[model samples]
Target: MPETTAASSRTGRLLAAPLALILSVGSLTACGPTDDGPHADGTRPSSVTSPSVTSPSASGPSAPGAPSVPAAGKTAGTGPTTRHTASSSPAAGRDPDDPDDRLHQWMESGSIPMNASYHWPMLDTSARLADGEKFLFEEHCGARRTPETDSLARAAWMEKARPGKNDGDQNWLAQETIAAHLQDGKRKASALFGGLAKELQACGSAHTSVTYTTRDSRHVAATIVLDKDTARPTTLHEYLAVVGDNVLELSLWATPYHQDGGNKPDVAWPGPPDTSVFQAMTTPVCPQGKQC
Candidate 1:
């Protein structure tokens, strides 16, 4: 069967299972606040563009009409730009726009397998970026050696050999699955973007916008913005990727004062980093006490 068709079928079965029941209960109760921080009423502001997914067949890195990179020396604060916000909906309710709903449904239906890769995009990003500039340096510099990259590559290979991870499971299957998918040739950038959109929507603020593009005809660019001050208290940005219908990957970034009220003494520097391909990917993983 075609992958989409099979995914649809699996979704149907998942919606009918115990996991679905649990998610339904949790979504209704444990999610987040419901007040629209900046853009309420389910309507995104005019300043922002709706989520977009560009398929591999449509265009590669040099595709015309793709979102352009910010000009050199331009800062994020030079003018108005779209921002991201967390979901404000009650936790127990189903996110009407959740892209992972299908995956969650499948997991609930008991389709989850043991020792499968799970891709957790949001957590992965957050964990990598929690330390700010240090984290950023590692992601872009490859200054440190870690098992995550190799582990993720191995997980990707294993996915074809067995059932993949399920959504809502506490295990790190989602991240592993995404790692595996990124290494897979068949996976497209659009699928990754689509999965990111779903995960962002589930957070509920409706002010977040995520965009991906090719930076300088080489690197894949991922950007997120938080529009509201209220939502900014929790997180400023997150990066995500989709491995498959059931797998997603993610990372987080924030301004220094995003969580605490303590403001930076100097003007905030914004825009993408200045680095090479090898540096950009590993800059956020530098070990503590090491200079990136």
Candidate 2:
């Protein structure tokens, strides 16, 4: 999730690159805390390094074809909007209740939960970036490609829990999720979740470690601590679950650091929230053979 901008200085770029990836995916709008405590700003530094999450051929952020990064204190572009419309008609002689067709329709508009989970605020697609409603095939963590999920229907959503005023200090929680249909869901879920876990493990000097994990037939969740070699390290949580042929993914990123305080940030985070909350959230989206 590295940003895609040239930095004024190498140190600035190095300092910014590690933090840009996920922030770039967000609004990058910096704001001040409305309350009395240290807050984390969901903004990106001026410089960016675009680690190609979708393509491996391209070198790191410095390579050509990297998207341009916005200047410091500016909002990151949300890319083009994409609308996913389920097929209106089924093939001739095919049952109207066809699982694939139902899956497609459910994935296009029915999987995400709008309610808050694990202390995170309610998620709103409208409150996200410009193209927040779009369905995405790309992975947030730098994964080469999701195995066995090509050409499948997918849905994605992202939102910030608390967007404070534009006063340069802020504390926010960023969250996103993806739902898709797979032929071999169990295998596909493992492949998808495994790829993400592998990529996240490479973060930081000692690399991020799995602080907690839960695995069952219905879902798998893992929380990792991204102690990157920077002034502020982030805590990222990811969850993956399978219900029949449907697979769902949820991710959360939060870092509480203030601009004025520099290296010393307030340790007020409520620890990594449980990702299992999404396991139940996925059932209603793609339950059994019924369309949601």
Summarize candidate 1's per-residue lDDT along 1-292 as a digit string, tens digits: 6999999999989877978888888896566433333444655445533246444344345347776454456654445222213322112222334443212111121212212233322322222111012122123222332354333332331211112333232221212122222333334334433433434443343554445533232223354444535433222223333323223222333333333435321223233342432232333333235442
List ranges where model 1 is wrong by over 4 Å: 1-178, 181-194, 197-222, 231-250, 255-270, 273-279, 282-292
State the lDDT of candidate 2 residue by residue for 1-292, as single tens digits: 2433433466787888868886865644345333333346654444444434334333335347756555445565432221122322111122323333222222211222222232333333223321122222133333344433222332112212122221223333334444344334556555554544444444323645555467655555666555555557665555655554444555545564755655332433344334435634464565556653
- Report the number of clashing residue pairs per model: 50, 5
User: Cα RMSD (Å) per model?
Assistant: 33.5, 31.7
Per-residue lDDT value at 20 in model 2: 88
lDDT of each: 0.33, 0.42
lDDT of 1: 0.33
Candidate 1 TM-score versus the reference: 0.24
